[model samples]
Target: MRSADRVDLVLRDVALPHLEDGHGGAGAGYRVDVAVHDGRVVAVEASLSLRGVCEYDGHGAALLPGLHDHHLHLLATAAVAGSVDCSDATTLDELGARLRAGTPRAGWVRAVGHHEARVGRLTRDLLDALMGPERATTPVRVRDHSGALWVLNSAALAALGPLPDTPDVERDGSGRVSGRLWRLDHELGARVGRTAPDLAALGAELARLGITGVTDATPDLPRATVDLLDGARRTGALPQRVHLLGAATAAVPETLTVGPAKIHLRDHDLPTVDELAARVTAHHRTGRPVAVHCLGVEALVLTLAALEDAGHVPGDRIEHASVVPPALLPRLRATRVQVVTQPGFLSARGDDLVRDVGAAEQAWLWPWAGLRAAGIPVCGASDAPHGPLSPWQVIAAAADRRTPSGRVVGAGERVPASLALGGYLTHPEAPAGSVRRIVPGAPADLVLLHGPLEAALAGVPANPVRLTVVAGRVVHDAG
Candidate 1:
């Protein structure tokens, strides 16, 4: 902490960019010199003279803050490993070819996007038809907007035996497991999946995308997962800061310290007002904010009620606040819950979203505007394999409000790309512990995009984020 000793690192002559300015700047964007000491930004300005072993030349490149995946299933995405991709087809016929050609093993057969009009409604009839005699042998699942299920044919059924009443199943006239399932949670046991990428490797992956940190979602924060990350940190492999999150209902783990609890009452439908209120009250008393997984409108309403009853106030992060029914806006306005969403959802599932939910159902898609207009603070996430691991794509989806075909679904809910960056670039909602913007006093968490901001956001055509840096470390170097 000596005055003569500048800091551990400094990023010079860089153009720092921000999604928005808070308070003083009203979304005041930044692009300038950045100085880092130890691990924190010491000062950010146009020019700075500092003595440090390591330095990054901004060269007028666009530097952004760290990106966070506020509400995500990163483990699931990671398990995908970029291999089996069903994200492109507009019809099941196309998917059928892909499936029959080289289906990955036989575990949970899934179709990413199946539009109703194009492919029609997916019922047990389709499952029976697809599986046919093999339904007795192979287990398959198709994932539409409504979720998915394993098509357990007779052999598969005999193997597993009578099914449980989870996911609100749709049965045939004779009243048998239809395989056309709803709510994929109940049928599956307490399945906790995580892709524990090598710490050094993960650091490199995140850095390439310009991410400096991420808040992993979980029921019980995976000790093994964080342990791997911790190991990476010790070995200089871990790339960014991490803010761990555990389910509110979980028994806190000792290995991790200081993080929010993840709440997902919508899928499981537990945590009545009393239960939620009690939990929030207790957690707030602990002096920590709770991040609720409320992607449905009904769930969002109930969440607000719980927060209010618990005597909790603003700054409590609300994840996936996508299903806000118009009526709830005024009420949400009265609270301090920050509305966070996965902007990448629009394009993530490709045609599947439109297929499963139908355009009418997608009328509100990832309602970014509704949240912003209500003055509810909002943030963004890539949602990864479910989407992609890049903020630029989120920005493109947010700004364009359309699909790859140039068709708009939730036009009214779109946010300007600049503003959406707040989630990926500025809002604390994303990159929980990730770096952001190249500014002095801030660790160099930056992205070198191929083009300028406007061009990067011009939809599918532009290539963004050629380089990513975190804390003066070159995670992704397009150069």
Candidate 2:
């Protein structure tokens, strides 16, 4: 390597996807030599004479901008990776067997993905009986995938002790605690603390899949959680850039830089218009964006109304406009709300959605194309433990709208794979309207795939990421 032309890194003979014509056809891209220096692309030419400290032979592989997940609960997803998975248990016996097999940590036996229909109703007495008399004293907790309900044994409830007499706590016909806790995750979590899996290792795993950025959309992020993420990033444990959306109220840190104030709304249980207006107005006054979680038509409508009344601020977002109808498109566009949607929901829970959502609202679920056509900016997300975390799976779902059962949910809303991939490239510097591309002066956050651009966009290949570079540094290299 010659010192006169030295650069940090260079990739020779890489196929660069045409910025606009990505996924157009078999030969939509051209080959170029790219040089990186000081965390940015310094050169891209048909051929380059520069010497690099590290030179990689792309061998004609496609090189593109790195991916991002616009919405995900980082801590929760990491926790799910280590939690006992009961998603496959089809009967009470099976679930009980799994529970019996679980090793309690800190006197708590926790499990996730509990399905009542398949395993029958779970109750305090039922859980106690399942544990058998010898181990009945152990505290046990099991949460369903929906994140709405939790079933706890008597010991578990006692551990938390003398809970507030709130509607979220359930009781049986005999006035005994039913062991079913509703929407009290934050409360329960406070007691359990941060017993999640290794967050640094989880971030590294994401890097391997070419994810260079993510928004941690965990509402009401506690100080401990925030500090944990900050420490990880400082120590280089986290390679992806993180943006955060907090709950209605949270401490805003300078470094973490709170991105939005998250408002969680449920169907028919929404706050009054005046209440919503007040919150939105206050957040705007404080220079924080508002991100509302609206999954049903009713929730979406109410949320849109609130945003309209408050007057849409620049960075305002709608997290999941899950069931947006054509009638609401004009209203939504007028609000100028940016949507962070979960196309991965179709792949993860499409079957249940088909059964639950009425025919009138069927096509409205995950209306990315419709939103895009309405001039509303849309970003794709993997709501993580709630949805699959794989960016490729999310892209496929957006492009195909196909469920695991092979049923297409909303064929009319299907988008070209390239367009879906572009959704992940929206960054603070690039914003919504700005074009995302790989060229000189752009940040060298990129992924090198083992195929041509057209092939990748037709459908993302499993295990396609050969290398991931973030800010000119190779974060993951399986090359």
lDDT of 1 by residue, 1-479 (tens): 44467566666665554443431112324556666666566776666666666676756655556665554444444444423444565576765555444353434343443444555566554644655564325544455533333333343344445666654566776878765555443233223121343446555666666666666654454455556545665566666665566633243344223356666564544568898888788778877778887766667878889877876544477777766666777877676676667767776543555655644547666777877777776767765545666666777787776665667767788777766665665534433223344444555555656545555556434445666656556667666
Q: How many backbone clashes are present in model 1?
A: 36
For model 2, give the 10-residue run with minimal summed lDDT: 19-28
Encode model 2's per-residue lDDT on 53-118: one tens digit a residue.
999999999998888788888877887766778987888888888888888876788898887765
Model 1 CA lDDT for position 438? 47
For candidate 1, which ten residues in a row score worst on lDDT?
186-195
TM-scores for candidates 1 onward, in order:
0.76, 0.92
Q: Which number leads on lDDT? A: 2
Per-candidate alpha-carbon RMSD to the true structure: 4.9, 2.8
